[model samples]
Target: MTVRKVLIFGRFERFWHWSQMVLIIVLMFSGFGLHGFHALLDFELAVALHTYAALALLVLWLFSVFWLFTTETWRHFLPTGRGLWQVLRFYTYGIFRGERHPYRKAFWRKHNPLQALAYLMLKVVLFPLIWITGLLYLFYFLWRDLPHASDLLFAVAVVHTGAAFAILAFVFIHVYMLTTGHSFAEHVAPMMTGFDEVELTPEEEAYLEKDQPAMIR
Candidate 1:
């Protein structure tokens, strides 16, 4: 197999990823504090941090959506049946035996089938759930005069908190998957440097070389 350095991530994507991660961590801390899970900060301070972090995360999300559509990269997240079983086997059985990954990076596909499916669930389901519940909670005052506003607020809070926990669970699984790479840093290094070794077909190699040469190292 030929391994050559190819650009896989863009600068803006890198910025968005790390920024989102930090903001989520901040929200987690402040959120737990606000919910009386910890006394890391005063109530008012925790509320301020959580609110600001959520707002910042929302802005990042908007930019990411724009980036996804404008670049036509949303197709990358579309799930595929190909290689799902191999990837699952690799992680479950083959990895410990030191087998190569079942999926390859291509000009068109960067994520494996399972990863793509997870992203779909995150973007289509969890993110919207969290955003809607969170927004309703944040702007509760606008609907405070509704007949059962207090009851609705309680429901929104419960859903928002549940979604936060779901996100945290997803993060844990993602982090654990990082170690399943050839080396612990094999996956993460690409995000940091925006390039990684990929086995490119002749057509992809030729196209990147001719049209997007900067992507080939």
Candidate 2:
């Protein structure tokens, strides 16, 4: 199979990915401190840092949402029913047997069925849940006049803490999955340079050739 270097990520895509990664790391560290897991930062300082990081994340998300809609790259995240089982089998059994990957990367479709579903869940469900609960926890004083303010605040804190831990686990899993590519550099380098060496099927090659002029612009 001929492998070719193709542009997979764009400049803004790379920027958003790395910036989000950094902000999430900062948020996690300060969140742990605030939760009394360790004394990395003073409680008040941790709260301030976490709030700032969360706000920055929100800004990045807003920009990202606009970019996705404008570029129509959101289609890349739509889950496919065609290869879900094959992808799951490849991960669970085929990979151990040294079988080929069931899914291939392409310019229009970067994610396999499982990846698309996971990312969609993170963006549409987990992210919103954490952000909403975190905001509620932060502004508890504003709702202190409510009859069950104390209980409500406690519930919000619990949800926020739980979601933080869930995000932390996902981060570790994401890092581990990066090494599963052709080489660690093959996957990680594209985020740095916006190109990846990928194998193209005959149909994909023909499609690329037909759209070559548009792709260049």
Candidate 3:
């Protein structure tokens, strides 16, 4: 079988991807350790490790955002109402038939409508909620000394814990989704090699030709 390889991820993009993965894994483990999930890492050490990893991940996220926006790569995340249903239906009912994905990754667009929406929510709501809430919890003791601040400790902890678990859920789903591609490493290979092997479904290809003139051959 012949496969056409298209460059999907840039060098810096892969760097950001892998680095963020390592940091997030470290943070998750350390954060859970701090919560006494197990006696692996002591509370103090876990807190320190979590904080450092969080900071690094936050910096990496910021840099990625800046790069995407400045380079106009942000278009990849534009949520499209038209293809949303098609993408969802395909994922829900089509893949089991060895079906091609309803949405195809193009040169100008890296994500499909569904991926765009999911990623947008992760960036705007999920990650920010986790970062902000976690930050507040991290500084809870220091801020508690301020008048009326003590009342927020419980609230902040709840938000932080909730966001953490939400992110963990996303991580689990994300990993599973990666396996849905042509091969177990089909999707992940692009993240490392910066190239993706794209195969389009007939229905989606026909739709693209009729709707997206620029994308039609």
TM-score each candidate. Answer: 0.95, 0.90, 0.85
How well does candidate 3 score on lDDT at residue 29?
94
The predictions' CA RMSDs to the true structure, in order, are: 1.4, 2.6, 5.9
Clashes of each: 0, 0, 0
Better of 1 and 2 by lDDT: 1
lDDT of 2 by residue, 1-217 (tens): 4466677788899999999999999999999898889997989899899999999999999999999999999999997898999999988899889888888776678888888888888899888989999889878879989999999888888888888888888888877777774777766887898777657777766666687643322
Q: What residue runs in model 2 are displaced by over 4 Å at the alpha carbon?
A: 1-3, 198-217
Question: How large an RMSD does model 1 have?
Answer: 1.4
lDDT of all predictions, in order shown?
A: 0.89, 0.84, 0.79
Off by over 4 Å in 1: none
Estimate candidate 3's alpha-carbon lDDT, on a 0 to 1 scale.
0.79
Q: Which consecutive 10 residues in model 1 have the weakest lDDT in total?
A: 178-187
Minimum summed lDDT over a 10-residue window in model 3 is located at 1-10
Please, what are the lDDT tens digits per residue for candidate 3 over residues 1-217?
2223555677888898899889989988998887778779978898889999998888898899999999888888887897889888888888777788877666667788888898899889988988998878777777878877866877777777788899899899889988885667766888988877545556655655578544333
Q: Residue 139 in model 1: shift from native, Å?
A: 0.3
TM-score of 1: 0.95
User: Who wins the TM-score comparison?
Assistant: 1
